[model samples]
Target: MFCPKCKSEYIEGYTHCKKCDVDLVDELPEEPDEYEDAPSIDPVKIRYAPNAIDAEMAMDLLRQNNIPCFSKHSESGGYMSIYMGFSVYGEDIYVDRNNAQAALDVLNDWDIVQGALGEDPDELEEPDSPEAPDEPDESYDNAPSYTRRRTAARVFAVYFAASIILASLFGALIMLLDILLD
Candidate 1:
């Protein structure tokens, strides 16, 4: 079955979600009496106490373990808004009341493993140290600089004069060609 939160798949008999820590069982107490003499106990719904992700993960785990599980959202919107906005309010996972405790135990085991690891799986790694500041180059700063305004103007003038001369030469050649043709 796929994890409702992370969408990760699990095999049958899986108790806890490997990717997310969520209980896959229902843990509510059984009804006090089937007969009229005893007061009836309300069925316990499997719910994620904290986040929708957790609830979805728990449902996925339950499905993998061959337990059918479903999400009960008070609001009709998607899971994110239901849990994130507190639209669902109380429990996030609703399982058969009978399976609640077993699911919780599975989740607890996963939590223990996470605690032993001493770090969150989702946490980003920090750099070992801040980057060193770039050093200023004194040699370049001390280098001599030249103004190119005069040089550029001189180059432009030379190019203009050459173009004029070339144009005149071309015109002369064309005139000669016309005379010869005539």
Candidate 2:
């Protein structure tokens, strides 16, 4: 027996495909050589997802918008995954050329909205009073830029100091070894 939907062969005892839940058939019809009646549609890449999970998410979003899409991963990814249990290579999602823009639009909307969901209602706190401040703090306007510059400078200083200390220690070790050897 074989599954008509997934086109996978099954044992004689199996009546339905576990993956597709479709009834098994004794034989599958031969594939047509050419699509003489079907309209021509070119596939266009819509997004390059960083992993299979991301690709699946994008495919789901496109499906919700009535856009058909498929994912293609690097050829080596499949081979490497056998040993590593995961593949680092990203997957590319493709859709019909006519629906490419619609697929992209749907993905863009999902990107924007996905981050704003799933907030815990019980964890949220309301202000004592819902009134706007009479005057905005002028100092707060430049706080982010100033804070960012200061933080970056501090990080650079720390790394520079650490490198200098490590170099001095290495030099001292070399001198002590030279003195002992001489």
RMSD list, candidates in order:
28.4, 15.6
* TM-score for each of the candidates: 0.32, 0.44
Question: What would the per-residue lDDT of candidate 1 be over residues 1-182, giving only the tens digit for each residue?
Answer: 54555555666777677668864443333446657686443344544344467666666777777665566653333443533354333234554556656655555566567667885745421211112232433654555432232343355557878999999999999999999999
Candidate 2 residues 1-182, lDDT tens each? Answer: 99999999998899999999899999998888786788767877766675789789789878887888898874456544464465555576788878866776777667656546875544332211112222433665567653443353455557878999999999999999999999
Which consecutive 10 residues in model 1 have the weakest lDDT in total?
Answer: 124-133
Q: Which ten residues in a row have the lowest lDDT in candidate 2?
A: 125-134
lDDT of 1: 0.53
The models' CA-based lDDT, in order, is 0.53, 0.70
Candidate 1 colliding pairs, count: 15
Going through the candidates in the order shown, the clash numbers are 15, 0
Evaluate model 2: give its lDDT: 0.70
Q: Evaluated with lDDT, which candidate comes out highest?
A: 2
